[model samples]
Target: MATGPNGSVLVLTNPHDVTTDVVLRILADRQVPVVRLDPGTDLHTSAALTATYRTGDQRGTLRTPSRELDLTEVRSVWTRRPSPFEGPPGLGEQERRFAASQSLWGAGGILASLPGAHYVNHPWNNRAAEYKPAQLAAAQRSGLLVPGTLITNDPDQAREFATQQTGGVVYKPLWNTPYKADGQAQQVWVREVRPHEITAAVAACPHLFQAKVEKAFDVRLTAVGNRLFAVRIDSPDLDWRQRQSLMECTSIAVPDRVARSVSAYLSISRLAFGAFDFAVTPTGDWYFFECNPNGQWAWQPDSITDSIAHAVADQLENGPEA
Candidate 1:
């Protein structure tokens, strides 16, 4: 592993991230300096930044209530789940919009532009990897087994595709975006859908439908750097994420074929870390579904979670390969 620039491991995330806390704990034990900031909420109230450029050199400082950090000293940036920028508190509608734009371009750009610091799956890379279409194309190119799939806005095509699947089709939200239901955030989980369920409403926008695998179980594989930790999840539900309590999790090794495919996929996607979901058939065929560039891993079994956290800490502490 190569050493990064000298200074703190900068963590840009919401204050309440349990996944981050695990890595932070290990970094703490290793006595690595860290400067945590939530740009969304803190930028307006508690944080300030200044950068100067002269004589073809750039230097800056980040000031927060608890710490003052030299911007150039950011060794690596973990842009983990940072919320959208929330501008100043009392601005009117027009002013708020303007402030929001300024903050995004100003603060967000600076963070993205740090001179010698490496980003753990940089924000731009994360956004690109989030697209299911891109992931599917990349997976196929990398030689990962992929289920028969379709993304369409035409109801007729959706119906035709669903009918062609012998094991039936499943509907999955392309983004799994949060929806407000009864004043609480809710998510639509993956579920089996009939051809009739592909109604005209699906024409309202693009819909992702896939041939449902009669999977013996699902695999959640967490890749940190070149290390992969996979957990086999056995569940009764059509979508295992629907009910985690009923999930039977056991650590599993990555198959050589799958490992090679994933490595190629990550290189193609320019991601240092990713959480991949796959469906394993009865005969041990692993089919790639999607890769989350900055997905959750701490929710896995304890050993897997701890090992991943340590791997992440090591990466942040030592930076990427030179």
Candidate 2:
């Protein structure tokens, strides 16, 4: 097998990531060098990285327990859910914060600046696509059907918009925030808005309200470079994630129009991988919901997981197709 300079598959993710574990196994089976780093734990603890630039050329090395990876020699980098940099344990809050900032820009920045290394979805690109409003706007521009949505901190405006939609509206957080109720962790799920539920508290923070699309099922399209895998998900709950055990997922074919839009969305977002969600109406029309640039895919069946793992490994081994 032909290998790149450093010839290593650098995977940046926490240890709990099953997706990364599966991909690592595939790369190993194929005899590709694999290096796993958890920035949160390994950055200043078990790993060391150094980057030097001189005469307009940059070079670096990343050393972990098992191997040393030449930054310039890396074939591809899989940037997954790396934990945030946390400084030493003994420092005060303010001092620790300062250290974290330095570590992030120092270590994280160098990783992001690796030359000739293909990032599965570049960290910058992943961050750019994280905004829900921007995702919706891009989807619409790509000729995908998007729900009529409103983002505001004005209760009056929110209520007015909710009343305007014939089928009623649903409220979703602009971004997910961790919450706890009665000492138990909870998540804010997309929920249909009741007429009486609209209140002045909506003015507290910016909220996203959209005309709820009546859908028979949800479709999750996982795009790996140019390969798109569509799955039909059926659930009785509005937010299927809340009741994953009750959901039935089946692999399905991507519609031509939807596929084109998916391509356009990825191009516009400058992302090589995206996990897209859609609401499929009874008539089969797909309404774009959002695309998670660094979304999870391990929960899928072996067929889907194997396909995704192969696609990712192929990209890492040979670099992205032109």
**Error in Å for residue 68 of model 1:** 1.8
Highest-lDDT candidate: 1
C-alpha root-mean-square deviation, each candidate: 2.0, 2.0
Point to the candidate with the largest TM-score: 2
Off by over 4 Å in 1: 1-5, 182-184
lDDT of 1 at 251: 85
lDDT of 2 at 86: 90
Q: Report lDDT (CA) for all predictions.
A: 0.89, 0.88
Compose the digit string of candidate 2's lDDT tens values, residues 1-322.
2236447878899888877888888888889888889877787678888989998778888988887878887788899988888986788999999988998888888888888788888888899999998999899889999999999999989888998999989999878888999999999999999656889998789989999999999999999888998889999999999989999999999899999999999999989899999999999999999999999988887798889888888878777792
Residue pairs whose backbone atoms clash in candidate 2 = 6-73
What TM-score, over all chains together, does every model reach?
A: 0.96, 0.96
With candidate 2 superimposed using the best TM-score fit, by how many Å does residue 117's alpha carbon deviate from the native?
0.8
Q: Alpha carbon lDDT of residue 42, candidate 2?
A: 89
